[model samples]
Target: MRKNSIKNIRVNEEVHRELSNIIRGEIKDPRINPMTSVVAVEVAPDLKTAKAYISVLGDEQSQKDTLAGLRSAEGFIRVKLAKSINLRNTPEIKFILDQSIEYGVNMSKKIDDVTKDIKED
Candidate 1:
């Protein structure tokens, strides 16, 4: 399938919605940080695997702990997905820490520093 094509977009949207609901309401794990958000979901064409990118609103340690919690609850999440979505096979879910927000913050800080140096000079 072509990247960013119509089909891929549809799959991504569906997976994202399902995952958001699962994380918010279904899974009852206490270890999962309450501030976690399902930033994006990428599903393969064959629908056998899904990469769920999560943006955690916390410091580095909190993010790491949240990821660990999600990883441990993968089986429970998959079971819920299988029952929730009508598919031949429920895709294996993989939790990934999405650092785009952090990257943006760092980039902005760098730009600010550069501007300050230029003004000083």
Candidate 2:
């Protein structure tokens, strides 16, 4: 794997932070649940595109709605992001549903069940 440059990493972090704040505070879309959160962001070295992972603390329907809302507001979000951060070119934002939290919870439960079985034996 190639190592990412310091500048690219920094840009990713700043964008992640700014996006989290904007989604949490500024955007007021009914489809976007209050439990929605920015999980991670991956920016290209050229800063031309960014994939933002968002976690929705709710059912599948909620997650779908949140992603839809973010995708719809992509333009507005990019504009706001560019205004907030001094970048030569604003990266295109793509919203993706992050199910890591749910997967982790499921894994934890499976581990607990296995441990319980081992203890029983």
lDDT (Cα, 0-100) at 48 in candidate 2: 86
Best by lDDT: 2
> What is the per-residue lDDT of model 1 for residues 100-119, given as tens digits with 9 covering 90 to 100?
98899989999999999999
Candidate 2 local lDDT, residue 110:
100
**80 in model 1: Cα distance from truth in Å?**
1.5
How far out, in Å, is residue 85 in model 1?
1.6
lDDT, candidate 1, equals 0.87
Number of backbone-clashing residue pairs for each candidate, in the order shown: 0, 0
For residues 1-121, could you state the per-residue lDDT of candidate 2 as single tens digits?
A: 1228788888889999999988998898999999988999998877789999998999999888889999999998998999999998899998888899989998999999999999999
Segments in model 1 whose C-alpha atoms lie over 4 Å from true places: 1-5, 109-121
Candidate 2 TM-score, C-alpha based: 0.90
